[model samples]
Target: MDIVVAITLFVLALLIGVEVIGKVPATLHTPLMSGANSIHGIVIVGVVIVAAHATSPLAWVFIFLAAVLGTMNVVGGYVVTDRMLEMFKSDKSKKGEGK
Candidate 1:
């Protein structure tokens, strides 16, 4: 059945996700977060497709949550990446005092 396949894929993805996220080191989290956002973009697309074809109120609710979460992932990732990169930018760049 369709539900069975969906659940199976979800479980597989969840397992793979756990394994992948568990391996990354804390110091690299910021840089990896940007890449993770790109990965979440794929999840966004998958969820959109599922949402579009979704039926029933419960399914819509699930789809909505997934979409919101995915959007947050992307937006938050960009914010963090920008801030991290901002810190890397020299103060002299702003003051026009660089060598």
Candidate 2:
């Protein structure tokens, strides 16, 4: 498990992720984001597990940052999903509607 190999894999994953996401249609982005959020929830769990075993100050800092960022990402995803759903809802107070 060399550092160089790990970094290379990370960079490759990043590039592939960006390319895949960039090609997604705007209409499908919300659903894709919703799914990604669920995955992030799992990431949060993993962070907690890592935090439990963390010993060094640097390890704790990284774990804390991961937890915070993962939580934010999950919350933001849901907010986006909710707003997208709202777009499809009809307004009851609109003039001729629901009269």
Candidate 3:
């Protein structure tokens, strides 16, 4: 029952994430993604909880995967946001030249 509910909610979230909100403007997207990325950092707390409570081998494996995936989210999000910021910086330079 819990698994069914979780899967249902996951699918609903995935659909909304991919289809519903993807039409926003590019300028809006960077800030939205940066905010969402901050929320993704909460995965670290979840990973810690899972790690501390894990007992079975399968549980340990899942905990390890969570740790790795969470770390990737933290690092990848920063890289992407930094690149996005650079795009605006270059645009600023172009505008300055025209002034």
Candidate 4:
């Protein structure tokens, strides 16, 4: 059934996301975040699919939560990436001296 497939995919994605969060080292975290930002774009497709086909109040609630979570992933990922990149400004750049 469609519900079974959706649940399976969601669980698989959740497990893989947890594993990825656990294993990534601090030094690699920024690059990991950039990659994650790109992944959030994929979640857009899921949002659209859920929005178009949701048939019941419970389904609407689930879809709303999914949309909010997906949006947070996207916004948080970009914010983290931007913050990481901001930390890397060279001394010359700080002095407004970059070529």
Candidate 5:
């Protein structure tokens, strides 16, 4: 694919993603984050596939960076989701301790 076409598609995707995500309700954000993390996991897999074809030091560096960033995104999403879930749990342990 031509570089110009690829860049145009990327820009369009970015704009659409931002618009869609911006409209999501706050209550649904955790689920959205979880879904995004799954997408990022696919991105990491793509990075690994790309790494296999890398022929230069710069390409290797970019692949490595992509992998690291994707991993961080997945981990961070899970942490956020976990914290959100914790908010909904009852403090049963605390109540029992007070008895």
Candidate 6:
């Protein structure tokens, strides 16, 4: 069935993502996440396109869930990227804070 295939693919992708990310070094994580964030943006675009054609109630539900999950991914990625960039702030910026 289509649902079965979709679920299987989703599970497989999840497992693969976990496996690949788990082996990355901490220092490389920020750059990798930044790139993945870009991919998440594209996912959002694709989900939007899919949502436009979603007609049935079940179809709409799946599209809604996908859009939400994709948005979370994009937001979380940017948050991580921002925190990582903060680590490299200039000395002047650090001293300017609360002074």
Per-prediction backbone clash count:
0, 0, 0, 0, 0, 0
Clash number for candidate 6: 0
Least accurate 10 contiguous residues by lDDT in model 4: 83-92
Model 5, 51-87: lDDT tens digits are 8899999998999899898877777777876766665
lDDT of 3 at 38: 59
Instruction: Write down the lDDT of every candidate, Cα atoms only.
Output: 0.78, 0.77, 0.81, 0.77, 0.77, 0.79
Tens-place lDDT per residue, model 4, 15-79, is 98888687666876777768677676669678978789889999999888888788788777777
Q: Return the top candidate by lDDT.
A: 3
RMSD of each: 6.0, 5.6, 4.6, 6.1, 5.6, 6.7
Candidate 5: where is the Cα deviation over 4 Å? 1-26, 30-38, 91-99
lDDT of 1 by residue, 1-99 (tens): 999999999999999988887676685577677766756666778888897789899999999999898878877777877777666565547667745
Residue 90 Cα positional deviation in candidate 5, in Å, after optimal superposition: 3.5
Off by over 4 Å in 4: 1-29, 90-99
Better of 5 and 6 by TM-score: 6
Number of the candidate with higher lDDT, 1 or 3: 3
| lDDT of candidate model 3 versus the reference | 0.81
Q: Write the per-residue lDDT of candidate 3 for residues 18-66, one digit (tens) a residue.
A: 8766567777677667857956777988899778888899998898888
Which run of 10 residues does model 5 get worst, by summed lDDT?
Answer: 84-93
lDDT against true structure, model 2:
0.77
Q: Give RMSD (Å) of candidate 3 vs. truth.
A: 4.6
Name the candidate that leads on TM-score: 3
Model 2 alpha-carbon drift over 4 Å, by segment: 1-29, 91-99
Per-residue CA lDDT of candidate 6, range 10-62, in tens? 99999988887767768667667696775656688888898889899999898
Model 1, poorest ten-residue lDDT window? 83-92
Structure candidate 2, residue pairs in collision = none
Query: Can you give the lDDT of residue 46 in candidate 4?
Result: 84
